[model samples]
Target: MQILNVFLVIFLIVAAIMVERTKDLLSAVIIFTSYSLMMALLWLLLRAPDVAMTEAAIGAGITTNLFVVVISRTRRTEK
Candidate 1:
């Protein structure tokens, strides 16, 4: 479990960096959503189901939808 936690942390960091470094807005938003889901999983692993669910609902669900909608309304690529 400890090793898994460490791996998850590493993955979260990488995903965050990817979100920042991507040249495409849509790709960045997708990576951010993935990062949020990973965070919810980490919360679950730490025995916080309520927080995990909240993160999943707010961060992964609504926020991702908003990002997608905004992306669809605007440009998909970043300058």
Candidate 2:
């Protein structure tokens, strides 16, 4: 249990950094979605089921959908 918590924290940190580091907008959105999901899981681990549900719904679900829609409307660049 302790190890799992530590791993989740580390994974969350990496996901956050990755979201910022990614140059592609789509990839960054994907990473942000993963980060939100991980946050939901962490909230569950911390005994905050209500917060977890909210994070999953709003952070991962609605927010991600909005970002995808916006990205689809914008022009993409590749290196």
Per-prediction TM-score to the true structure, in the order listed: 0.97, 0.94
- Tens digits of per-residue lDDT, candidate 1, 1-79, equal 9999999999999998999899999889889998999999999999999999999999999999999999999889987
Error of 1 at 72 (Å): 0.6
lDDT for each residue of candidate 2 in 1-79, tens digit (9 for 90 to 100):
9999999999999999998787898898889999999999999999999999999999999999998998899855445
Query: Which candidate achieves the best lDDT against the true structure?
Result: 1
Those runs of model 2 whose alpha carbons end farther than 4 Å from true positions after fitting are none
